[model samples]
Target chain A: MTAADHAGWEVVIGLEVHAQLATTSKIFSGASTAYGAEPNTQACLVDLGYPGVLPVLNREVVQMATLFGLAVNASVARRSVFARKNYFYPDLPKGYQISQLELPIVEHGEMLISDADGNDKRIGITRAHLEEDAGKSIHEGLDDSSGIDLNRAGTPLLEIVSEPDLRSAKEAVAYLRKIHTIVRYLGISDGNMQEGSFRCDANVSVRPRGQQELGTRAEIKNLNSFRFIEKAINYEVERQIDLLQDGGTVVQETRLYDSDKDQTRSMRSKEEANDYRYFPDPDLLPVEISDEYVEAARATLPELPEAKLQRFVAEHGLKKDDAVILTASRALADYFEAVAGAVDATAQVAANWVIGDLSAVLNRDGKDIGDSNISPAALAGLVNRIHDNTISGKIAKQIFEAMWDGEGSADEIIEAKGLKQITDSSAIEAVIDKVIADYPEQVAEYRAGKDKLIGFFVGKVMQETKGQANPGQVNQILKAKL
Target chain B: MSLDKVKVQHIAMLARLKLADEEYASSVEKLSRIVDFVDQLSQADTSDVRPMAHPLDAAQRLRPDAVTETVERDRYQQNAAAVSDGLYLVPKVIE
Candidate 1:
């Protein structure tokens, strides 16, 4: 949609994200929560909703939720109830989904998202509640009937709801991204959108500038990617504005974003709107978290992304952008810390190698930092070489590539390939004398006040040494010779 | 307060139950009595008390996060009306 389309209207957006908690077992059952198993094999009697089977909540789920609550600076509920949301579908083996209604586990949370102006904007979180995921329904394969796989039916999820604080699609993306980073950093969830482990639905509406009341909202459902979230919200905003301009009122409904079409179409209208008669589940009692439990969970939290980013900036003097990229994942952050700590005097140099060359190699192979062929210590060895002038930065790149190819450590590669920088003054002077003799005209030019000719001499000596001479020593010696 | 015909119909629709026109009279009376009884229960003043979610005051017992259940798909799928490749088959539902 064009900016002119929403010129006079203010877009209001809130997100509802469903993150599957990474646990060994399902939330209420002993069924394994591992993905990609044979259909219905991991589903047990409790997950299949067999009659008279009771649900016993997992202790680790609460601990993880407490960790998340503390990470977001939120209050952990002392008592939270599990309510049953009544619905009927083949995918829902149980007639209703077990969820939280009036009392959620975490509430009044907020996170800071970098606004478009590059300022920290605090987005208010309404609540994050615990819920159970439904099963998968396959429709195409069977002739007359659909197939139901209850494997994912009882998996635990945290449904995080945000306030209507976002003003633009960019801000929505930023807010969603912050949530994704927080959940992954907390180690509570894998936050894999492609695997449907982390998914979101957007509630979007628009109003004329200066109008207090909000326009009728049409919810865009099941947006799994950041780009789609922005695109779907923008499309929905333009649609509502166009409808309003045409003297037609917007209808409140649930819409699906067709990525193929890049548009959100209504899934269900208000007439078919959901009426989930939520009541406390009688099978399970209330979950009460004690102060001691919260303290223990707090102890388990490592430095969060924001804290680590600030530490990188304040302690290591890294650029904010570089720090952000380095701390995007826990493994990457740890990798950077080790590399930087090894080369204590020059962390920016360490940052450059990790964020630049090592990242390029990892990206080229489509591998994560945890899966990089070059270990952090080996990369640190390479970085230290460049700092100590054992190998010039130019030669270090060559050694880096060799190390990525499993050619051994940086020092080993230097020895095997003979790519060490020539730092000995005697050896450098010999190359400089040869350059001065070979280019007496240029030396005479240097004497005649063409200072630019120094570059020419430096290029030659570097070429003579096959680009292995210490550049600083080359410059110092070449000036003395002329 | 009594549940009227329209309210009863909406409740039935939400429950996915289709009621005939003749069945609405008795259904409204039965459902109205249920609502009225709940309304009577609401007359007690519990404003100072905490909202009770369960009848028992005991906290929910937690099990350790360990996979203790094994796959018994063949045994469970025996009661299915139809089965295909170890999947329970029902009327085609798409949304």
Candidate 2:
């Protein structure tokens, strides 16, 4: 529950996400756009804004913006103009940043996000415009001097703005994750938050529950992670509610979320808001995209996250939650489909193993599905063994661990360790007889109306066979004997 | 829309420029004239006119996505006033 529940206020949130486009060079300059490069190495004369240099548009950036617009079902403007937003900062060598103002590339798009109740909530995408990124300023360990790295300068970015439609922090995260999945599916960005490839700024406000007008908003900037976004919005919402309860008005300003302190503080007041002196950039011309261009780009779009999730449920007959988790990432979804096709396992069983054990191991090791050591074929082999009763699910887990440790394939490990299930009726009968003899007192108790003691006999049978006996057969034989 | 000495000083501060006291008056006058000239365009009725962002009617020209330039850290950093460890050093920025 949110603080709004008690305070009788509702939280409203919108997100502005800046995703660095996946391009080999800077947007305007012929400079390498590779991350982690030596400082200033990628800064060309145009990037540095030399006196006589002008910007030429990067074609891939426009295509990427169009592709995102198509993915989100947005209207791709046929003509978009670039404007110069004037500001002065050390990191920005140019006095102004080239961005979209009056005319953006994409507008009026909507995305469907699954809320906490598993209901689809549509979030309005206000606009996604193209812009250039600023460089970095490092202020650590400098002895009153700051280091400037222009490597990120001139990098192409798509600033996707959202309408203030989210009611809670969880919804905001869901929206963010949906966008992250879409971008990754499009292969337009690495979507690495830590590496600053995808960055977020949240506009948060709170008002009385029945109030129609929105309260003043505070924009929390540079939220790089999903956890931070949720935490920061929650904190900001609480801060606003408390202030309003005490008859204080929420201040409209820019705040920075200090992750270490778990709080937000004022970065700049409205008075410090830059005029920006926005005007059309004279150097670069307006971008014109044709219908055919958009159609071609649309044809190349991969199956989006929502469609994939629906298909995973419809075709695979998987649980909705399981399908959502399996289709969270494209690679994991592909892995599941491959394993399901290779083995004779039911969709339910396949989903359980993949979402249960495989995800747990991946999470524990801090690895992505793409980095898994267990190949899809090997996992399918293991599942096939379980299907054929060569091993029970419990015993297969041990084989899975051995496989993860590079012991061998599932079949090879089972053969080497002699861990196959004892499904033969005669062999299981022998184990059950010994178990009944050893548990004679419990058996007498069971026959004298202690039906619960059957579990004790089953345990003994399992221990006698070292958990290799088929549990179903053991239960059947034990019930008959009793 | 109007320029004055105080507003000029604030602009200079935002731009990170230092102007002598004697130069403020002249700078304010020059900027005011430019603004006044641009303000004249507002007098003409533009309700039916479409807004234009660029003088040229050409669309944006796009280049193929490829790394066409090599790293030139030393040469690029040579343009900075001060540099150390492949970074451009400036006066400490608090935030």
lDDT (tens digit, per residue) of candidate 2 on A329-362: 8999999998988889787788788898999999
Native contacts recovered by candidate 2, as a share? Answer: 0.86
Residue A249 of model 2: what lDDT? 88
What are the RMSD figures for all models against the true structure?
1.8, 2.2
Per-residue lDDT over A112-176 for candidate 1, one digit per residue giving the tens place of the 0 to 100 score: 99888899999999999999999999988677789999999999999999999998899999888
Model 2 global lDDT (CA atoms, 0 to 1): 0.90
TM of each candidate vs. truth: 0.96, 0.95
Against the native complex, each candidate's DockQ, computed on alpha carbons, is 0.85, 0.74
Q: For model 1, name the residue pairs that clash.
A: none
